[model samples]
Target: MSKAVRAVALVLGALWTAPNTVIGLLGGVAGLACGAQVHWRPRDLALVFDRWPWGPGGAITFGNVILHTGDALDVVCSTYAQRAAPCADPDIVLADHERAHVFQYMALGPLFLPLYLLCGGVSVRNRFERAADRYAMTGRGWWPWP
Candidate 1:
């Protein structure tokens, strides 16, 4: 897509997910006071905070904001991914998985959270998480299975 078109799409996506984004921003604000570092990735159209020191030792994405427990976004989330096997894809990264969530929240808006919980919360059995991993591994399939 052209830059202008992509920019407009990004604005609309961010707006669509604004409510959750606000919550994520609030968490980030709190994390900042606790020594979390934040950065904006223009390519992903997302904000990422690292060393947030919360959750299950990986990362969680709310809308386009990602809070990662680690100091970087490229590591395998073995402690929290809840998968049956270790990731074998050398090119796959945790940031890609979180970015898939950015799209999921953009698509589902506020309903995403409740539905995510209903779908099994943080388990790898969760379709949302499975889809995110799919995207991370294959660079496609971010939508939860029907």
Candidate 2:
């Protein structure tokens, strides 16, 4: 993509996904009140809040924001296995999985949630989650659409 094209795409994607991003920001701001810390993940094109005060220990993505219950994004955050991940020592980054969801949100906008629920709403059978898992592992093919 040319520079101008990429810039336009970025603006359009941000606008297209803004509603969901607003919802994420609400949670992120709440997390802030509860002592969570936020960071920018340029690689994921998202803002991540670490040590969020709710839910089981892991992470969740809403548009371009990721709320994680852990101290960092450098370790495996999924309940599933990632033994072959690219971390230097033990564990691996789970940002890729959530980032996949962010991209999904950008592509589908407000339609992503209903479609996700229809696809099984976060489980082994959910094509969205599966595609995300595949992308996090192999680093490609994050798009769930045929």
Candidate 3:
């Protein structure tokens, strides 16, 4: 890859591990404020939990399997072994909503994470939830719970 590409990769990699630095911090905080917790798991999966009050909700990531918690987009599993169970007792009503957000990340690519953070810290959690719901409504046909 070219030097510019490499630099961008490095920057993104660092942001992935921890997004509370420099401009990336702004995004991270925004996401958190919006109730979008960023899970920097070791694997290449970005799980988005749609929890209210910052602790209860659904999550989504891409791997090799799909987890159904009554959501639209399913968490992609990483391997065939993971495909055994499609519905997990995740105990959340918005797994599918979060999954759609995960798709949003996919659409935004690297910029998604940072933007999520910023949104979290900037917007009120409820507003963030509504915004996410709006996105899901148009993109995934799911409405936010009242």
lDDT of every predicted structure (CA atoms): 0.84, 0.81, 0.39
lDDT comparing candidate 2 with the true structure: 0.81
Which model, 2 or 3, shows the larger TM-score? 2
* Each candidate: RMSD: 2.5, 4.0, 12.9
Error of 1 at 4 (Å): 3.6
**Candidate 1: worst-modelled 10 consecutive residues by lDDT:** 76-85
**Over 4 Å off in model 3, which ranges?**
1-57, 60-93, 121-128, 135-146
Taking the tens digit of each residue's C-alpha lDDT, what string does model 2 give over 1-146?
89999878877887888899898899999999999999999888899999999997788888888999999876865423333345333333588788888888888888888899999886766889878877787778789875
lDDT of residue 56 for candidate 2? 73
Error in Å for residue 66 of model 1: 0.5
Top candidate, metric lDDT: 1
How good is model 2 by TM-score?
0.87
TM-score of model number 1: 0.87
Q: Each prediction's TM-score against the native?
A: 0.87, 0.87, 0.31
